[model samples]
Target: MKRLILVVYLLITLGCDKKYLEAKPDRNLLVPVHLEDFQAILDNTADMNNSTYLNFVGADDYLTTNSGYQSASYLMQNAYLWKADIYQNSQTGDPVGDWSSCYKQVFNANVVLDGIDKLGGTADAKLAGVKGTALFFRAMAYFNLAQLFCKAYTTQGAANDAGIPIRLTADVNPRPARGTLTDTYRQIISDLESSLVIIAGNSNFKSRPSKLAVRALLARVYLAMGNYEQALFYAEAVLAESNSLLDYNTINATLARPFPAALPNGNAEVLFYSAMPSLAFLTSQQNSIHPEIYNAYSENDLRKQVFFIDRGNGIINFKGHYTGNVLLFAGLAIDEIYLTKSECLERLGRGAEAIACLNQLLIKRMKTGTYVAQVSTGSNLQLILTERRKELLYRNLRWMDLKRLNLEEATALVLTRTVNGVSYKLVPNSGLWVLPIPDNELIAGAVEQNIR
Candidate 1:
């Protein structure tokens, strides 16, 4: 029956050639009439596990070997090089899998938000939690969309910069225009702040978001917008609630695989759960770790052992995913909070304080006794930034980090790639930073294409 239901879901989703966002409702499937029905829609991991295929491909964390390069699909190959059109052929269908999935989640959330008020009794009593969770999910979906479709939020031009459309209602509206970057961010923050007040303190299940999850996500949003104060405040607020770390020392690093393959619901550090598909080409040995990043880890660093699989071919593949599944985790975790706080402190010139936070996180990640506390004098800011890169690889934060970090003159970087002996570069603040909307959406007249 579960298999039958999934087949029906896929059939309904795939049968339409109409715009993904404006597709007519499936008359055969049950409408989410009850609160639990809406909750079940949220639980549909197929639609909700936000995939970061493009972000993962676009980031500079991994280098594709010639073999891997040739074997990859055209979409994957183009994405790796920051091409103007990732989907070169119109026959490839819409290249908006992540975009469509995100908004689908938004639609589900909106359904819950729209319908909950019409019901009564116990479901109404539980409305606060339901509403908060729906809001959080919608905010998360929009945030992800903004990062891909909009330019990095800069104070000077955000009011003019185009952002992804804001879909706040569940009505079958066919067309929605893009909002300004400022408007997009305002909606995201408004939803998060609203969620914080209503969401309960913590969830027994990591998959269900809570107050801490909302705070952590807000910190990430502020950090991207270069709002160091709010970022710091939220990071600290979450830490105050809970700052548990997964001690790498306790993990078995000697096995063929190190981290647990199935991160249980009660995993100590994960604040929220979401994952990207571990597509074979991305995680396979042919796509090796960037040499510089792999070499940066010290021999005693437990992450070096637990997070990678060294094939002895002088290249390593990542294995230290928080989700014990093959899927790469893009969820909120305490380690990210610590790093955000540290970056915020350093950016605010609280050098000593920043190093203290870094030191606290490192103690758990390093070998039991060999870990030495790091001090942030002048050189330590680089250390903290590097640690952030190393810790958050493949989590879909690197692209945003690149955008934000490149804004600072000191840390400005131009990403480069070499494939088949041909080198390509993506300069800092290039228009290429904003990805084009999928072609099908443009053809359908439902969305405008991003300017390249």
Candidate 2:
């Protein structure tokens, strides 16, 4: 009779009960997935794919790097280029796998969420907390797609421009059209806001979306939209919760040697962070910050010593510690929140506060007495941006920062190259700024390619 009941349910859903009964889910499948699994997946999102995101993140890293590779690598670097330029056949689909990956996360979260609603759980409050975290990851996954595949949250929207294909439900057939920027942001804000409520009451989210994490994400969204006031509001809230900094000063000694491949979370400074996807390409691409950037660091500046690996060849990749190991990213923390706050303050004419926030971060970066902020003569905006560059260099936020600050052109200015010793400008806001949608997906019937 139990088998009969299962057959009836499967038949109702798939019009085929035989397959379902034969598949036979194991006991692990029978149990409700909790915050653990959901958090585990969220803990692994990384910087520009390294290898994964690089396909979609575009070759800004390479094209823009003074010492990096040239057009051959840059041609297919990311999803930003016009399809005609590379694929030429319009078959490459940027939204395909991402659409699938994000939905996988969403599915995991939904199973957790619905299981709590139907099967019941160990604790009502705990279940609710798990639900909140799932919502945050789901939103984050979608937002990641939106920013890269969709147009900016601009005056004109999906009616005229492309937005990433939004996936609200779990169905796989008949993939949907790209959402408008407005609609995409609505989803992001909605998911985050709801998650905040659920996460606020529970304390078990050791590494998942804590109340602070939600706020940090919200601030990031606001910052992206150029909504400085709202950005400041949420950023300030997250900053208040952090008690530590990744202080650049002790980097060399803290972990010692080649570093641990990845920094652990809940550190004095790491509000929330994953070990992250290891960057083994260092052996090949030799990826690192430009030497000019390394030189810019003050002698007193500790971040350079801690975060950078200066090869003294006008190139300094991340130290052996980060890129060597680790296969994760995306947890949470106060670092980005502080940068968001600083930018918001500068935009709002709070120069002193902006500088103060930057100094707070910088001060912690250097020896207690070293590297003070001198009164700079340029726009406070530049100061905030420079701090952002120094602070978040290797974490996958730089390109977005360039976009948010409308500095893509400025970024482009510096991202030129001399292949065969022949100079070439990397084309600001180049079609290549976005990556080509991945090649494998175009064969699928449902996925839509980005404009290129």
Candidate 3:
């Protein structure tokens, strides 16, 4: 079934010029029809689990020298500078680009969902699991796309804000128009809430969606949306089931890849497994940690050694990825849940509880004996935010954090980059935070492009 799905995917996608919305599947080709076949479509991890890195490239966690900036592809160089236009009229067919990749995941999820409906019977555990998995994938893809392509969700302006096109079916002929930010997020939350009722508990294979994975994703989505109460609800739900954090002291920081391979990810911290698609600029040795971010970690913080490799002359390359390799892990993990929980607690005026919760994870991350429990004070919010930045670097959360935090005056940030003696800055709430739609999609004339 997997091979069959792959064949159909290749036949439809290879050398295709039509937008994802308009490209019709061949009627003559064998299509997935059975329950297992639909499951196979969801099981194709390469398509289902990999996501875009444009946000990562545009984020402030890393920096590169002028020569290194020149070495990057034109698209990435623009991203690094937070240019008004990053694509520069590039076509959409590139599978790793933000628009194409996320839409592809949405399409596949819709395929499985549409097929499941065609089965037309009372669903057994297997059938229900497949349905839940499809819903989770769709919601996850939508949440990720929203973070990059739409304005940050706020209670006030969401109704007026433009959002990515929301496609709910497998049919390709109908070009859906961009929906309201409220509608888009409502759909995401709806799908996740529905999946929560049907999916089983945590699966041994992290690649597959489980009950806890759904909760973890819900926690993350709510956090991004600034619904701190609901976010705390979901975060605590996940921690109730599984809240294991890897002790960095036990990991060998000297190895090229310190963590275990993600194929059989031994890292107990991971909840839902997904990775950012690889790009040359992100993996290049010339890329170094931003000084502000690098200096935040105290010398006794084991992450300083476990997460980075000093390449000499103060240039540091990140080696600590939960995916256990060069590919940045964008999936949910327990550590992130802790951060989310702590942040919510603090925002809700439970400062002492937030500090206690944060310390549970921080103790494991620091050297066993050198760790000091953080005290709850006026600085508790800033303290948790700092630790959040330090712990989740390169996991694809920083960009979203920047967007959400900037919604408030106190947490707003001004990001800057210097390339060839030229300085570029992206202010809080800049229109550039919302990326432009791919030119190919714009040329198709189905949806409106972002104003930036």
* Residue-level lDDT tens digits of model 1 in 79-156: 889999877775356546676778777877776777676665224536778788888999999998888888888999
Clashes of 3: 0
Residue 196's lDDT in candidate 2: 85
Encode model 3's per-residue lDDT on 336-419: one tens digit a residue.
999999999999999999999999999998888988898998559989999999999999889999999998899999999888
Model 3: lowest-lDDT 10 consecutive positions: 14-23
Off by over 4 Å in 1: 1-29, 90-95, 120-123, 261-263
List TM-score per model, in order.
Answer: 0.92, 0.76, 0.95
Give the candidate number with the greatest TM-score. 3
Task: Give the number of the best model, judged by lDDT.
Answer: 3
Tens digits of per-residue lDDT, candidate 2, 1-452, equal 34433422342233112233345345343343444543343444331122224432342332234233333243332232323355444343333444445555555555455555554642567667766776877777776666555545554443565555565543334446654567778778998998888775423323455787788789888887778899999988876666466655455543323333334332443444433334334233445555556667777776666765555545555542333243323334566778888878877987778887877777777777767674534468766777777666555565555545443444334354443555644344454445445454445434466654
- Which portions of model 3 show Cα errors greater than 4 Å? 1-3, 10-28, 91-96
TM-score of 1: 0.92
Clashing pairs in 1: 261-324, 262-324
After TM-score superposition, what is the CA distance of residue 440 in candidate 1 from its true location, in Å?
Answer: 1.4
